[model samples]
Target: MGNCIQKTNRVVLGFDHSSGNVSQKFSRGQKKDNNYEKGNLAEWQKQKGFGNVKKTMNPPQTPSVSGCLENSHPKSHPLPTPNPISNTCHRGHKKQPSFLPLPKPEAPPSKHEESSSIGTLQPAEPSLSLYSSSFSCILPMPMSESEILSSPYLKAFSLDELRKATANFCENSLLGEGGFGCVYKGWLDVETLTAARPGSGMPVAIKKLIHSGFQGHNEWLSEVNYLGRLRHQNLVKLFGYCLDGEDRILVYEFMPGGSLEKHLFKRNSPSLSWARRIKVAVGAARGLCFLHESKSPVIYRDFKTSNILLDTEFNAKLSDFGLAKAGPTTEAQTHVTTRVMGTEGYCDPRYLTTGKLSVKCDVYSFGVVLLELLTGRRAIDETKCEEEKNLVNWVRLHVLDNGKVFRIMDTKLEGQYCKKSAYVAANIALRCVNHEQKYRPPMTYILEILENLPSNKNLNIY
Candidate 1:
């Protein structure tokens, strides 16, 4: 159901389904709509008249293209009713795959388009099915490594058990390759997230890291520490991890929509309209805002498209906490200075030079990602000439140019984005990436702008 991320270049964006996409109605401290917690998705969908699906033992099949989120609640956002399809998979396990095929690599940017980070899109990897269940799990930290075996959140798995679940790490189950190593798709119980036989429980993405890298171990521990400690609708759920001697693996709630990276940058994927992009931004912002607002604030050093995973409903959930750092607790201590660590293009420019970090550093990175969504450009595009390589610089210049804001937009949008929202987004992004960290708006302020973009300010075509 809505719990799994549709791994398509999908759901139209903004946590658009498998990750935590915030239902738009709630203000800070307000309770989420209880209707969203309804037990039977098929029953709820029928009552709401969503998707026009029929009642059955298995859930209805979801669509490849995630539907749009309006200035409304989950009940009000008109779902894209997909045409009916078989609800059962081979062995009768329910498989609701909503993957759409990608188009050819877009034509490389012409030299004339100097300001837009319009690098050529690459072909997406093979599509995989995104599975979701109605159940949700809670995390309880382990007291020690021995207690990890008993921890409710960080479950321990034996090498033999993991090997069996992943079918000895078969190549066919490979989901995607990255710097860390290979990620295989595996099966687990819906509630416990413990290993289960195929078709017996829910599906999960198992990330197996090469045994030796310091970064891998640190990142794995970081993910376990943060995701294990914090619980939020907009943050990815880390069900368990394995530390079997030389084998180190992390288990996460498989995000079928993959990363916001795939949707915004991959070729052949359906384009994210203006509204959806705004939704995704707000969703990610909520996750960051939660961290900043915590009793012990956390700075998510890496806030980029790749780390934002989407669920089946295109709800955005923040994943990968390797770079998250606790903020200064005392009011007298303004910032925490440390060795700089972050993605190449999305790092806060001030943090990069000063090696001094603050909650605002995250705001800066978020500004970069926001610009990416607005312009459909990479933060750093080496393909572009020296002058146009930096997205923020280029966008900041163009955003200030009256009547030229469209020059920074993604061409694939086909002029369908809301001009007013796009302009507001650009203004926010500009403020976020300001050279001086103090000039950046707090995440809460950013949240307000995104939430009210379509409604608070009059909507005018760009």
Candidate 2:
């Protein structure tokens, strides 16, 4: 029994250090490698509250929306089986074809031209006229692979330049590892965006892809397509990319505060005050709202605590666009039908069962994060008793009950927040997580509720 439990831990909860992003799920037939070392496992168990488990196991094969699934949890607390959808096969879909060949890189624009053009570009308006013109040429509608590759907004870096920036991808510089590959800490000149000494210039996070990993060129292209054009304070800034030889690398601004998942779940981290939690919640909602309200709406297929990054000031920004999809283009079309892909517990029940996705899917995910903020609990935790294993299921009743809501609030908060405000936030989460897709509030509406919560900045901290 002990060996069985140890194997289960490896298969289900393989921990990725630095960033808490869950590792990719392994298929039943694939060989299991010891990707995570024993020392790292010990540290993970200490920090995350897992006890007496040391090995990883590959569990029975289950139907996944995408051929690959992200961030799976323990088998004892398996995700609810999705109901079948008409026209959808029970077996996971095959890998889609690779994107078209990228056009040659255009000459870098003059500093003045680059600065001036960026200022004129605005978020796509409801009319979409802005997106349909010059902006639309580079947008991800039908995904013009050539236009996205040549856009002046992104810089094309040579492999040698990145080697200097990342100290040859040194082991000490590693920030985290995920399904795609490992992320490393690097530095670059603020103005020229060229490689710089370790402690001298601007810091950046470089994601270098593993050629053999589950994610591949398509996912890398998806990030460049969306983030390459869209710009907002709430979204992480993509500085550039490297496509030399078989290597695929992405450069993004370094987020000094790490991920929200660490702050909320890591044992020794400082507790986020009530006001700070509200601020983070509002910031994250704004990012999602921006994506949904765009001229060409975007569905953030993967939304979870680990993907919500923070800066030194505690401002939250959304990251990881690998699974994001473009929404329906015409009003007549209600939802986009695509492969299901997302973290296990946070995925919308409707989406998982039907493979039909819309902006409401993102709303459901936001609600799960909101609950995490209010309760300081993970979406899934095997350490707890069966009844309490799933955070959403366990808290649904308590959050709705006026008398029980307070009991569920994070004890770390120490009753510093206003009961009235807390109750209002709880109700908003309940509405967003409603099983019926239509009942879920849109990201815009959810943003309004979070922003308007009274005394958001000045909540008594004592």
State TM-scores per candidate: 0.68, 0.70
- In candidate 2, stretches whose alpha carbon ends up further than 4 angstroms from where it belongs are 1-142, 401-403, 456-462
The best candidate in terms of lDDT: 2
Model 1 lDDT per residue over 1-462, tens place:
221111222221111222334422100012332344545676455454455554554543332222211222321212232222321222333332222211112232244431111111222121211122222222343456454344444566777767767778899778987666688988887665567885568777788888654346656777777766666668886767888777788878788889998999898889887667887888898788777866567899888899999987788889888778879988898799765667767776566555678999899889999999988888888779865787876774454433367899998788877775666677668767766666577886676567656542455554
Query: C-alpha displacement of 17 in model 2, angstroms?
Result: 34
The alpha-carbon root-mean-square deviation between model 2 and the true structure, to one decimal in Å, is 19.4
- Model 2, 279-349: lDDT tens digits are 89988987887687666788888888888999999998889887788898789988987655667678777
Which candidate gets the maximum TM-score versus the true structure?
2
Off by over 4 Å in 1: 1-151, 401-403, 455-462
Write down the lDDT of every candidate, Cα atoms only. 0.64, 0.68
